[model samples]
Target: MQKDIYVVGLMVDERSTKAPDVQQVITRYGSNILCRNGIPSPSRERGIITLTMEAAPNEYEKMEQELKNLHGVTVDCIHFSQQESFQVCQK
Candidate 1:
């Protein structure tokens, strides 16, 4: 119900092989994603992606699950509610 800020950390394995499918899922939820940053491992076989999101709870949860469903992906998240975010800034 409270939609504020959500951070999704995505770990991708075999970048060249798995990225397209991962990308498809991301594109489906593109509107809710505020920004995305992806960094590849030095070997270029793995990647870490961070996404800043603002969306309804269910929407983002679904996105998280979909990413998790991928074979070579790992997902993690951090959430901040609207009031909590303001409180943090004021501190």
Candidate 2:
């Protein structure tokens, strides 16, 4: 098994999709959103949504691929924390 990862999802829309649109993405990806922020987009009718989530290491790639394919949703970045391995000292 791989180490757990932290993923950030950004919803950038040229034209905002409704609630169903956003929900659909979450459902499809099975991602647990940790935090979210929304702001009005100056260039278009849509707004930008930023979200953070914890992803299962094994499933990270699949989740990212699915999310990117969703309408009005794009992954801005994916961040991961290195898991340190420790060993017991023997006398």
Candidate 3:
């Protein structure tokens, strides 16, 4: 089966009020996360966070829903498949 790559973008208007909650939710699904990047405004009032991940459709939707449920936070995601089967390769 093919696996899709999902990129989730999060924007928080109230950083101090919402960032910790967002982080906690992200941490809850850490195993599905491939990478995470966050940028905070100089004044710390707002911020943007990006997460790159590979997970089952249900898992991805669960994460998205959790983030969306947070107050003062906006979430968006893009997912695509490269026509390649997903596999785990160990070194």
Model 2 lowest lDDT segment of ten: 82-91
**Top-TM-score candidate index:** 1
RMSD of 2: 8.8
Give the lDDT of residue 7 in candidate 3: 82
Model 1 residue 82 distance off true place after TM-score fit, in angstroms: 2.1
Full-model lDDT for every candidate? 0.83, 0.58, 0.81
Question: Residue-wise lDDT of candidate 2 within 1-91, one digit each (tens)?
Answer: 4554454545656644544566566666554556666676667766666656666655655666666776666665556645643222111
Report the candidate with higher TM-score, 1 versus 3. Answer: 1
lDDT for position 35 in model 1: 98
Tens-place lDDT digits, model 1, residues 30-62:
998999999976777899999998988788778
TM-score of each: 0.84, 0.57, 0.82
User: What lDDT score is found at residue 31 in candidate 3?
Assistant: 91
- Which of 1 and 2 is ahead in TM-score? 1
Q: Rank the candidates by lDDT, best first.
A: 1, 3, 2
Badly placed stretches (over 4 Å) of model 2 are 1-11, 27-31, 41-43, 84-91
lDDT: worst 10-residue window of model 3: 82-91
Error of 1 at 71 (Å): 0.4
lDDT of 3 at 78: 74
